[model samples]
Target: MIKLKELSRLYNINKTIVEYGLIELLPRQHRPFSYTLMRIVLFWVRTKHQHLSLPERLRLSLQSLGPIYIKLGQMLSTRRDLLPPIYADQLAYLQDNVPPFCGELAIKQIESSLGKTIDELFENFDATALASASIAQVHTATLREDNREVVIKVIRPEIEKTIQADIQLMKWLAQLMQRFLKDSERLRPVEVVYEYEKTIIDELDLMREGANAIQLRRNFLGSKLLYVPEIYSDYCTKNVLVMERIYGIPVSDIDALEAQGTDLKLLAERGVETFFTQVFRDSFFHADMHPGNVFVSYDHPEDPLWIGIDCGIVGTLNNEDKRYLAENFLAFFNRDYRQVAQLHIDSGWVPEDTPLEEFEFAIRAVCEPIFEKPLSEISFAAVLINLFNTARRYNMKVQPQLVLLQKTLLYIEGLGRQLYPQLDLWDTAKPFLEDWMKEQVSPTNLLKKLQQKAPFWLEKLPDLPELVYHNLASGKSLQKQQKQLIVSITKQQQKNSKSYFYIGIAATLTLVSTLAYLQTDKNLAMIAGIPGLFAWFLAWRHTNNE
Candidate 1:
């Protein structure tokens, strides 16, 4: 059940929703044209909602909500498969670059959480935040213990209240979708929201984010593609976190990066590589890879290091999903549209009845147009958007992780475009995917899996002869039963066939007799004559043949 307060807020939002002429965006089965007509009238009544495009309306609504809604909007922005290209582009701007709370509040929160004063915790702490966001804000600081420069991230005060309220709204909307939307079961909106709810709620507690960061850092501790900041344990608290900070250029600042003589091409390629490596190898990725959350190390301009901040939203894929995704990427790169469509069906992205050839043609229709275009000219995001829209015609189920992955991919592509337009994602990603697939299917992997099951196999070996004897005996019994069953089925089928033949013969005889008698009658003199008799012979021949 939804709270009255939350319901009222939705009603107010619905007011704007009506004015925007967007109630049609909702699933049609729910409204019966009532909602559509009402929204059209509302649009005429309010000018603020009347003139905006679809993307602008989405942006405005997200902005009106709190951080949780901002996060939700950001998530939605990644789904090119579900939304319009324009909407995805506009929602990408919902990074929520708000002003941070006062430094005094930051210090107080830290002191309260750590049971120590700020003076004892750090030698130097900046008052102004480097950047503030929906969940937390960051400030640069230096630890007195080791004279190490670090950044302090503190969760917002009273964030839970707002987040919980917004989550309630999301849950309400999801329930509505599950209730009225066509194929609501496939959409699984409620489950997606629940999954997101778990992640964002965990993010509210900085300790969980810290643990996720530490695990991720350990995964790529010595690796080259990206860096996860070190979490300071002693000073860490529920709402406050201390982590080692390094100087690097933000990934978004294209001009600054170019001016610093950074190898934009190499950086962009490595960015793609880093993403695949994290997703495939580590299975834990720094999900939030926006410009503000990432930076480049200037120490090596030719090979810039990625410095990842903000571990609030991370993604993990089960081995099955990972393997399917890798295969999909490989298939896409190979321009195997049929395999892509089949993969969707096999992976259950689309319904089982989705015709493979039709889906293949649809995929090719979207992909064939941009086959040889340079990566810069072809918008990867747009291609995905088109592909997704096409799939909706077949009622394709959206992959939640793919949505996250797509968002990150767009993030990567957008960053690449900003940095180096000529960077080819396929070229960069193809080799990585190939190598990863090789590792995944290597003999070593097989051996390792078998090795884990070796003990069980060894124990079962001694009983093998007995097991085989039992199997042989059972097989003989099953064979006898099968033969008897076959005989029964054959006899029954023969009976059915003979019965059908007799029925056909009887019907034919009846028809011929009726025609012959009618031909003699004055009423059928012209219609039923020698032609009817000849037709009767032909019908008899046809029935007799059966």
Candidate 2:
């Protein structure tokens, strides 16, 4: 059953799709009969954006739908495997450029979340939003305790309900696609929607975002490559987050960056270095690296520092993934297509039965052309995209775990090239990967691992002798029990043999008695019968005695 509100929302969504001319974007042959009926039913909702390209209109329809749809578009942009390059390229321009909600409402929500009045919590609080995004908006304030400038982020009122409703609709639509589309399995529409749902839902919890920001800030505390803003924990809540305010030039402002004499080349290289360091050294990275969330610190123009904001979304890699990924990158750098193919099999990214030679040839075919140009002209993201596409033909499933990593890599590479066109990503990353690989097997790393486990080892050291003694005693006890069991079995077998012998004698006597009776010999019969009875009693007594 559908509520009136949801039905109304759906109708509006359909209207937007029609107005943006999204249905025409699909092939005429592919469009379902229902689509034509929809056009007739909603005849008033004609196509309004005839001037825009199909991709552009598609992007506009999603944006007009709301925050959830806009976020969906942003996520889909990273999925180059599923969408064409033109659609993906247009969707990449999707931004969280939502209109700000009421400032009074934001203040009330913050006060309600913090359980205090706005004046009681802070001084010089600004009602106007510092920034407005899809999930939340930021407001500037001065903390009463420390007099430090900070930004307070508040979740929009009833945003979660809207997100949940939209997600439900998305899931329903995904099911329709899976049921009707010929090759929907390849698209994995349901799984993609579920992924987007989780990501958007996670962004709703401001406390998780605060923790992520804190961890990231600590990881890059003294680093020149990146700077994470300090989160004010005491004032933070699930719906409201307070963090130190930062005034840095947005990374997209190329003119401003150049005007400030910022070292663009070093800045670009540092971006690559920062990504590798987070992925390899720390195993944690800011997954959302769009220009809106990235900025340049004004303090260091000669040695630029990146200021990261909106740490609501982050990606982490375990040791296994990190190691395999490092090896894969190194293999790609060396043009070792065989090793690359082997790593995919070893990592269980592809089926073990996938022919090694065929996979290697396919990868080489797609990737070899990428290296023909100078290293500076090559695109790391392009190489990865080609590799993934080639692997898909061998029945390789998409790795949901690596989705964020792939998206982040695309963002970093694009940002790097935008800052410095001739950036040699391979040259910048190869040495770092080599050093990291060396560190994995180094004696120092071994010592470090030992140190990490020393406390546990020490805690159990006192119990070792007692545990050894108990184990030996239990073993001897078990052996003794085994011997006793063997003797008992032997005795039981002897008793059974004696019982069988008596029973055989009893049977012979009974047969003799019967033969005598048949011969009409009373005396002989009586004698035999009495003996048979005695033999039967003896056998019974023997069996009972054991």
Candidate 3:
């Protein structure tokens, strides 16, 4: 249910979207108020922004709407297939920068949450924020106990209320879309918003974020392709997180990277490799990987490395999804459209009743065009969108679990293209997928699985003899019961056979009587009727006896 307040907020949001020259994207017929009100808003607002492009206005409008919209805009910037190239390009530069809360308020928050004064906790705390974002601000500080350099991250004051209100509004809008729009089922608008809600809310808990960071750092321990910073857990809380402060070039600053003689192609390819390694090898990945949260290590310019930060959101896949995804990627790489179609039906992604040939043809049509270009020139994001749209025809259910993976891939791909235009995504990903698939079915992995479960098997081994004895006793008892049942069934069958015999005799006598009557022999017909009556009595007697 949508409250009046939420509806009003949605109306305001729609108005803002229209003012940003995105009214055409709205279902004008479904939203009559927006359609009419947009015309009026456009009339007044057109004069001031006639010179600005739609993409610029879109970025500005999203930033003004606050954190949630900014996040949505950032995700949309990588969707090269859904939007025009110019729009995607412009949105790619949408910044997450926001004004930081006052330093005094941040101090007050840290003191209250940690139950200690700033002086007690820090040897030297900077009043100014090192970085500010929609959710939190980071300030450089030194630990009083050890004089170690760290950054204190504080959640924005009273941010929960604002987020909650907007979340409600988004839910209402998603419901409206799913209810009224014919194509919204494939989009799964409500589930998408719910996923976004969970992610953003989790971001508020600095402790959980810290744990995520620690786990990711452990996963990539001593790796050269990517680096995750350590978390200082002793000083962390739900609202305040303290962690090792890192210094590196922002991933977006390509000029600085080039100036440092970083290998651009190697850097781009490494980004893709990092994503695959996280998802397939470790099953844990940094879900929020926009340029702002990523940096390049300054130490390795020739063999470039990535430094990941902002581990607020992470994604994991179950075994089934992992296998299916790996198989699908391999199939796609091999250009086996029929196998891809079959996999979709087998995996229950599409309905079983869907025509296989037609589905295969549709997939081929969507995937074939991309292969015309060299693998280096093909856009992975565009291919994904085309495949998704094509699958919508066969009624593929929206996969909510893969949402984060999709978003992260988009970010990585977009970033990769920016770093190196000729990066061959297929070439980078094919061998990785092949290796992952092989590892899944390898003897070593099977042995490892058994080894991991050996303890439980050993624990149950002592009871095996008793289990076997009981099983033997039960089998003997079942045999006796079966024999008794067979006897009863046999007796019943004999009684039915006797009844059928008597019935046959009665039928013959009746037929004889009818023949005698037809011959006009009255005496003979009366005699035959007496036997027919006798046979009927015998049949009834046999049935009664049984």
Question: Clashes in candidate 3: how many?
Answer: 0
The lDDT of each candidate is 0.78, 0.86, 0.86
Worst 10 residues of 3 by lDDT: 41-50
Error of 1 at 192 (Å): 2.0
Task: Write one digit per residue (lDDT tens) for candidate 1, span 330-397.
Answer: 99989999999988999888989998899899999989888767655777777887887788788987
Candidate 2 regions with alpha-carbon error over 4 angstroms: 1-13, 23-38, 49-59, 72-96, 172-195, 465-546
Identify the candidate with maximal TM-score: 3
Best by the lDDT measure: 2
Which window of ten consecutive residues has the lowest lDDT sum in model 2? 74-83
Q: Select the stronger candidate by TM-score from 1 and 2.
A: 2
lDDT of 2 by residue, 429-451 (tens): 99999999999999999999999
lDDT of 3: 0.86
Per-residue lDDT of 399 in model 1: 73
Report how far off residue 49 is in candidate 1 (Å). 13
